[model samples]
Target: MPGFSKILIANRGEIACRIQRTAQALGYRTVAVFSDADADALHVHMADEAVHIGPAPVQQSYLNIPAIIDAARRTGADAIHPGYGFLSENPGFALACQHAGITFIGPSPEAIELMGSKRLSKIAMIAAGVPCILGYQGAEQDDVTLTREAERIGYPLMIKASAGGGGRGMRLVHTASDLLAQIRTARSEALHGFGSDELILEQALIDPRHVEVQLFGDQHGNLIYLGERDCSIQRRHQKVIEEAPCPVMTVELRQAMGEAALKAGRAVNYVGAGTVEFLLDARGQFYFLEMNTRLQVEHPVTELITGLDLVAWQLAVAEGQPLPLRQEQVQLNGHAMEVRLYAEDPARDFLPQTGRITAWEPATQSGVRIDHGLIEGQSISPFYDPLLGKLIAHGATREEARRKLLRAVQDSVLLGVQSNQRVLANLLDHPQFISGEFSTGFIPRNFADHSCLRPQVPSDAELAIAAALFYQASAQVHPASLAGWRNNASVPLHYRLGLEDQAWSVELNAMPGEVYRIQIASRSLELKIIECDGHWATLVIDGVRTRHAYRLEAGQLCLFTRPGSLRLTDRTQALVSSQVSISSGTLKAPMDGAIVDVLVSEGSVVSKGQLLVVLEAMKMEHPLKSGIDGVLKRLQVRVGDQVKNRQILLEVE
Candidate 1:
């Protein structure tokens, strides 16, 4: 094998950092590339050398094939590693590197091209005699052809972009009426996301488990299957939780699936690390989904079970090394599970949030591994995926792994930028999840009420008691703090505090250390103060017997609790009126993006949830449907126009 002196990582975020660690450990210098937004990113700062590609927009920067090739040439890098995103599956980029005399550390360009298209990949799978979902793969651009195919295939089908993944250009149509509109919208999204609008229809399996096999191929034409990963726990087609050695797959099923994966790999002469995905139905019938021609986001689970560094193997194969070990030698170890920690609010429809990570701390223990991209004070921009890191837990058994993962989750202290940590913890403790009886619809089925996530506001009596305790604690720290005096006469101390939109004006009499007697409108409450540092305070209210933590930041009060917390904004500032309120009879765009489709006319009458407009943002099309059944009073946008968050898209009367 020809050893590489230096390797250039053609991606960013935790994946780049992950590759850098493995590459450097193998005695190779790593070159990292960054856009304007990632200048202070952890991955760029950790690289041996860094190069600026372009602006924050991915198209001009991360997706710029020529710029990446140029960076590799300038850095004297022998090989380029596309770390699972951006141009990772771009066959054109691979061929470009080949022509430039630089090693593309992945499968051959032909393999990538073959599997890149959903239509062609299905064709290949069928030709290989692999079981596949029944769907129409014929060319159908117009709505009429698509509608006919939808009827022929039956209802409850998935319209998927042949050139895209990550749930970007996919739509679920349950009825014939919604098929045409969904197809048009899906095509537009596919074009915007993958630069191609070609799509294929697939039978949407009910209660399907998303299972994938990890395959590795070497220069000697040897393809081996390491193991399998269960990534059925998903939201919007993006994997959230992944586990190794699928809990449902028996030994017999594993051998069958493994052999099928190897056949798929050899059929395309695939090399490097790749995943062959399949959907396993409730009846144990598995159907070939597609093959990702690069390392998967959830590769850590497979690594934990197999005790192998897939990245290292990729480098070895790229350097012309044959498989060092045979498939028979591979041992499946204990169970492992990983959860993706995203910088988005689960309560807010998982919208991408951007802000400074005020506090970023994750647990690192014997069985826990946290692969992260951001650090304290790092900014999360909207131009990229909201993923911050992946938390993986390994154990001797699946039950042990689940318990360890739950414990690590509780120990994590990720603050600022609303995260799905609580949601993950909730899922970990779910009865179905714990018993391994969950499917793709687990989250939806469990969290249908939504009330569990949104905590009710604390009662006024509770807040007054908490405030009195806080005043006493302050007075104990400073003798004259909570008590106002004139001519040695004691008076009530006036203070302002808040709790989740409810404000309070407290009056207290200071006593000794960490004690105070307070009154709130004919009610007397005892106080006990625990600790205070800067704007944060811990105090216990009399009769409540519970210690509560509070923090004052930017004239707002934040209270932290176990199940949830409260965010109180001071009403001193001018209150900005909501842009769209059904009460005001207005409909607004939910995001900042372009108007990809105008589904309603000026004088058209529509019902609630009837598609009125489709706004594309972050490569996903958000259908802005009518909030209420009424006349389309006004259509404020056209087919092609830039819109901002909360911009009124239309009005209904």
Candidate 2:
């Protein structure tokens, strides 16, 4: 085996930071490449040396083939590590690395090209005796032909784009009439996404679990499977939760899946780390799905349970090392689970959110690990995926791991960008997730309309007494008169205080024997003030036997609620409110991206949802839709335009 001295990581975030730890531990110096936006990023700071590649856009930086090759040449690194995304599975990039005499730490260019295609990969799987969904894989495709094919195959089949994964260019057909239209739309999307409109068909299972087997191979042709991971908890085909040693997996089923995966691996001569995915039906029958040629994002859970560093294995294998251990030596241990943290608002349909990370602190505990890519004061730009980090926990049992993970998620404190923290916290306490009976439809099937507690507003009675006391004490010039003012006042002062655009009139009447009677809005409120100092007033409200503390900030009363730390701001007008620009004929960019395609002239007739143009940002394509049925009045930019957040691209009239 030829060992490498130095390696260059061609990716970013937690995966880059993760691979560096593994390679450095094995006596390899790591080199990192960064874009202008990532100058202060965590991974860049973590590497031994860093290089400036290009601007913030991925195409100009991470995906730039020439820049990457130049970096490898300049750094004099022996090998390059493509971390998961951004040209990780591109055959051209792999071939370029090989031609430059630099080892690519992944499968060969041929293996990548074969397994990366959906149709060819399926053909190889079926030839190797792997069970597959009943579908068509021929070149002839049209409305009539596809409709007939769908009828023969069955209803509720999947029209999948043969290009890439991550739920894009895929459609579910439940009826014959919708088949043709869906196929055309799916093909267009696939063509736009993967530069290929070619698609295939697959029978969609009604109730199935998404299971995957992790496999590792060496240059000496030794292959080993490292058990299975259950990724049934997903939303829109994106995995939100993952676990190892699937609760429903049996020894016989594991062997069947493992051997099939091995055959698929050998068919392509796959080396380094990869994952073979499958859909397990309720009857214990499994069908082959697509193969991920790169290291998976959810590899932490597998490592937690198996006590293995898969990245280290990949590095060793890339250096022409043989398998150090046999398959019999691989043993599964305790249960482990991982939850993805993202910069998205669950309440707003999980829309992507971008801002500065003011505070990012997750609780540190034994057996619980957090793989984060950014730090405090870092910006969450709209140019990349919304993912923030992954929280993983391990324990002797599933329940123990669940409890620990839930605690860690609750204790996480993130400010600035809106996140799915509350949603994750609620999921942990859910009965279905705790029982491990969840399927791929768990999120949309249940808890879709769940409403979390909103920020509370302070009641009127709580603020009335504070206003009366403030006026009375301020009137007394001497400290002694203000101190004993409550006892000295004959007729109690009555005053009205405003709280959040509302008013509460209070009357404090002193009766015989120094007894104070308080009236607020025709309702008598009984309260005893135990202490009053500066801006704080402590009192108990009627019907609720609780003593609460209130703070007076800038002529407004504020109360803090427990558990959630919900604050009730009692001011007439808020200090600031977000303002959305409301101007007709002004087109705003939906995301922070660069203009990839301009499809309209200065003046063109357009209808609603018409594709005006296409924007490519964060490796995902977003088509700008026409807001109203009107004419394209103006074209402000052309192809390859660099735009900012909320920048106007064109005008419509």
lDDT of 1 at 422: 74
Model 2, residue pairs in steric clash: none
Error of 2 at 126 (Å): 0.4
Model 2 C-alpha lDDT per residue in residues 514-559, reported as the tens digit of each score: 2346777777765555445633445545544444343444444433
Clashes of each: 0, 0
Worst 10 residues of 2 by lDDT: 560-569
- lDDT for each of the candidates? 0.80, 0.78
Clashing residue pairs found in predicted model 1: none
Model 1 lDDT per residue over 294-397, tens place: 99999998889888998999999999999888988999999999998887656557766566676555777899888888787787776787788898999999
The TM-scores, one per candidate, come to: 0.86, 0.80
